[model samples]
Target: MQPTDVSVSGIGTYHFVYKHDPQTGESGFSHLITPLGTYRTFSLFTSLGVERLTLVPWALEAGSQNAAVFTFDWETRVPPSGFFQGYPLARFTWPSGRRVNRLWAKRLVVYDNIQINWDKEDLLDSTSVELHDSVNEFNIEEKRQFGAGTLVTHVRGDLTLAGTKRPKPKRSGLLTYTYEYEYDLSFLVSGIRSCLYEPSTASPLWCHRAHIAFNSWSGYSISPLGANHFQDGLSSSLVLSQTGVQLNRRFDNSGRLLTFALQDSKRQEAIINVTFVYSVDSLLPSDMNLETIEDVPLRTHYRRGPGGRIEGIEYETVGSSRRRHVQVSYNEESRISDLRHYISDSQFAKAGSSESKHITTKFLYERGLLSGFGSWKYTFDEDGCLIERKLRDSGSIEDLFEYDAKGLLRWAERRVIPSTTSEGQQKTKLEEPFCNGLENACYPQEMGQVKDYAIQYLYDAEDRLVVLRNTLEIDDSIQFFYAHPQHRNRLTSFFHHGKGKAYFLTYEQQTGHLFTIEEVDLSAAADSNPERKVYIIITDTEGSPIALYSDDKVN
Candidate 1:
């Protein structure tokens, strides 16, 4: 049914059909007609359960490149008709209709939101492979509890591929971590419809209950821990047995987190702790306390002015008489106008330190856009893209930039010249001979004195950077390679014309987990052995490189 009145509340619903014509008694409303013919029909007296079935278009020729996939699996085989089967839309069943509580008498447990096929097999796979090697692989196991409904309540994982051969106490300098969760069932808002009287059902919500870690770097294992929960169903405290580390949390009556502390149980001292103090009349934090395993604990107090704008901040450290203060002034639009930082000189402060060591920074805005700050002035286009930045005193361009239609940097240039008063000194400094080991610095500065340098970026049709050349080295540039089928979204190799070197990258997986780079020298002597270097990248759990190891001296 369609409504005659229009409402712009919420997301502003719109009627897509054209207006009806009363003269012709015709309504301009039609169902979306697709090339695929009707595949299923429902009887006039079909059960409402059929509404739970969902069918999606599945084109046999669909692929990443949008080209026809010639090869087909047995499950996705095409028909012999030349016209070709329009699509192979897979049917999926929604779990809402088969929820457990609705059919409690049947004594059956149903996993909420888990898609299943006709065979009652789960479509959502919960397995993940983190790390794999020839000897071992690291996998994480998720455990779900099935009482009223299914909910993940435990997580068990280990990092042991590189630790098997090491001593039990020193397991390849890695940490094995585990997590456990606790949940509580409560009734919460489910649907949003004012006219409908849908009842809210109680569901289980999980919360972190315990975190365990075995740090091989410290040659110690943290034993399993059990924690108690607060009235709000939050973990209140956790204690690690083997390792003398304890975590504690405190909340206010309103369930607002007040403090969280990580303590060394053996010494009965907090290693790191943070506390939030709220104002008596407002919900905002009035002050905060941060205590690390350092010499002193730092306290920051916030002072708010009219409109609840923070006007000042005061910092004080325990066992120290001196304090640091920051004064903030805001414009009419509530934007920070200026900030002044200085050391407070109270009677208990150090004798020599005073407000004389203060630093002030002012911000200038034009039409709601930042125009200048400190000794630099910036010019931006209508779209708020910074196009130029120059020194306010000398009016000399310090940096210039041009962006493409999509706001990606297309050209950039930098001009570095000392101020008029210091040009002579800078020239002398540039011409001065450096010590035996430092010649590249003076050589580069000498070349920069001749003219400004600019760089041009060239991208392919996919908007992937392909070439980069600079004005200083017009004939030499860097070329990137992504031609191979395996290098669709990953960089395969890059050649540096200026350095006469080509570097190839290798990953642990096909398109992820970069692990190594092999550098080859192109300018090496023909008869002599060419110079080559291989660098190994060590990555962490998120597939981010944490360290680089290479054997340059040996090579």
Candidate 2:
């Protein structure tokens, strides 16, 4: 048996293991239990393979075992391939005997003759009625194509082919648009392929041929995902002689990425190369090796237990004296209990160097929930919302969080308690905010604090923060406003009453916070151009702000 995927739920983490039958050459799983045997369940398979795993907790009465089982029902019959096809998940049955039926478009035409499985439903089921009902059936209009295989081009579906029901016009509702595909073919001179022969023994010298590749997507009107700036192909070396660069890619038998290399052909050296190694038995990533232009090799090795859970990781720089090792210890419930980090200059030290710095983090759990870590104690409400977090060593209440019935954070309080002196006098009070109780509190307000600070939040109907009131002496209240219906929940501008200033923000669809315009003294902005400052934000691929650029400075 080999471990496949690990599922982590609100209760516990469960590992799914698959047993292979040598005689039948088939993969299947019968039953699975959590590490501590707290939950038992099995896999749910449909024509589309395993959909989800059910959770079955032990019941006091033996006859109720089957009643505790959770299940999912899927339509096994394969639907037609064209147009808006494939029905959404049928229903979900919970352990408490509750069932939810879902219906919406779950597939879309992502490319010519290619449709991808994706959910198009919003939280409130605000999708257009025509779009929602068009997913279950197919039409002959969708099956018509211009060509076959790589040259195929699909016809756009007309509004007449849409569902019969028309949705009521709403200013805030989403507008569904149909897709159109246009293909344009163009060829580029990629590289020059040459054949060489030994000069001493060959009568003829060598011949070279120019390699040209053609690309078509309606004349670049519709490129693939990510704009198709880079080349993607099978496991092979793609040499772009025009740029003197070589892109080398390798894949395993199962089509998993194994290695990728980018080289400078003129220098005859690799600019960057990465290799991925996976465990033979479980097919899990075991190691990663990277080589840079500086020729410094960095390697990371993963150590796993019998159940394929990562127990430790070692990072090393080849030929360098620097090394770091991280060891993970799990409790009987298979939850990470401790994490120890050891850094040393000696690479081959088996027992690790005693002189090296060692840092360890310890975790404690109560009733399957993390209760404390290090010197910090945490308390949660019945809904699992963190209510209070206190530092045991310092005897200080770090944060007392309060949540409303909707599970939204309403307020948070931090208290600082001064220690007693030898003469029974109170120690110096820490520089912290002092907040008084407000209206509509979720968690009980904590008492006994030399100094305290609190912040209360107010949300709009759409759950967008509209106001923030803090106990701070300055900037006590900040009100946020959203004016752009297209951007939805994004903030358009915010006013700082104490500072008498306002900030207008613009966002890049993916990167976020493209520019911030700060206005000072809103009262004097009627005729005067209030002092304004603009700051540009830089972000990474994942839309996380990495740096702020302003006045020739990056922060």
Candidate 3:
């Protein structure tokens, strides 16, 4: 995937204003953006009592570009009635070019009806309402009111910088952004009506009473469960009782109690005495499934290096979906034969078991090339090339080849059924790289005549194959350089010449295992010093590496 464009309207569109020092040429800057109006609200209602409103703005857009225009609308519904009233709480424009970004929603407006009493203390009996735009589905509506009580609302605001600096391109780095918002709610009542009952005849009564506390600090609590792998943030307590309430009785005393109360006097009192407690607990682990791999056994021989020395050989029974037997053997040349052979019989099914046999094949070659198997029937041409390849119970192919005067392969072709497409045929092109490297000095007679070809060779200082002045192709080319130490038996590769130019890959001296990677970018400014960053990775037995430490020059 390509890196997103750094335009004003792209994914990472947050504008970063830079401040440059004239004397030292050092520069620094901060990111800022206006608030995008998205908020969450908790609403409570009783049949006859007041309805409480708790609004929280979802100010998580800490690093987003400022919207040209923003607005919030809240729609709330009172139970037992179908009609919903919407309130537009706040609207304002933010000043441009501020060093510190602001996510605050200004001029918040809350609509209140005096006839409907709000029960702030009881949230379980409360219902949540969401306000949505009729036109643009992406736009979210913000809540206007805040705080815990029906008669009063409080508003609070806080600010903090979004976390660490942006990462250099193509280098693995972490990006973090912090989000914060101040909350406050003020009390107000505009109008009231009776949607279910006649407004003139219906008597006003308080069904629930609630208490809402503000700015109260509650003690912290820890989770009893063990730590989970998937939890992202630190475990912390959630402040409670900042908003509290007591629900009161609704409707006339003569009416029978239903959803909110019991008939017995003691039962009614117990129901009224019920209280809610909000305590913080650690987030639980995400759900996951585990799958196990079954072990299979077989007899085979392993070869080590170019000379094809028999490193080791083993004979064992391998498990399979069906009953089977395996046999393996090696020739004096240390080449293994019959690597895998599967056999199945029908008579074993009547005996409540299946029967089959398996065999493994191994080979040794002079160089990196593989020789023929020992046990399987095989044939080779005068050039020591495999002529016939076959698999037991499946099919076989006979290769036909023609050679030139120098014994170089020419006009090579394989004849088989048109419908027979084998796995080996599909992978033949992939072996061209190794084959070309093995035949280093052999030049193709018809090189220019071939299409879709690549020149594969190692060019050393002595070669100096080609040189030109102001070469157009060389100027625009991207090059990757790798070097393997001859004496150390290890590889240390580096990347050069690219956008955000850098040096990467400082591998181990013995195993070629990567230990550390350092990246440097010089594309910022001609006069400015290049930025160098280093990341150290530590690996466990399973080859899973964890970042141990990191140091960077960017903010």
Considering summed lDDT, which 10 consecutive residues are worst modelled in model 3? Answer: 190-199
Q: Which parts of model 3 have CA positions greater than 4 angstroms off?
A: 1-328, 341-455, 461-489, 494-503, 509-555
- All candidates' TM-scores? 0.36, 0.42, 0.22
Best by TM-score: 2
Candidate number achieving the greatest lDDT relative to the actual structure: 2
lDDT of 1 at 357: 54
Single out the weakest 10-residue window by summed lDDT for candidate 2. Answer: 219-228
lDDT rank order: 2, 1, 3
lDDT per residue as tens, model 2, 1-555: 366556553235566656667896645775566666544546545456225545454442334444355666554343433432553345566554445444334533221121223233332122222221133221211121333332322222122212222233211111111222333343221322222211122321122222223444211111111111133453654443334455466777776557766655455766666777887775666887877665578898999875778899888888877667778888866778997766556434665442255566688875456788766788865444688888777675578998643456878888766555432333322332321222111111233454577877655434567557665533456656554323457665666645656665544322243433334444342324556555544332233544453443435
Report how far residue 113 has shifted in candidate 1, in Å: 41
lDDT of 2 at 8: 59
Estimate, for each residue in 164-255, the C-alpha lDDT of model 1 and write its tens digit. Answer: 23332221221222233333333211111101000121221111121222232322221122222222244354443434445466767765
Q: Tell me the TM-score of model 2.
A: 0.42
CA error at residue 322 for candidate 3, angstroms: 8.4
Candidate 1, position 385, lDDT = 62
lDDT of every predicted structure (CA atoms)? 0.45, 0.49, 0.27
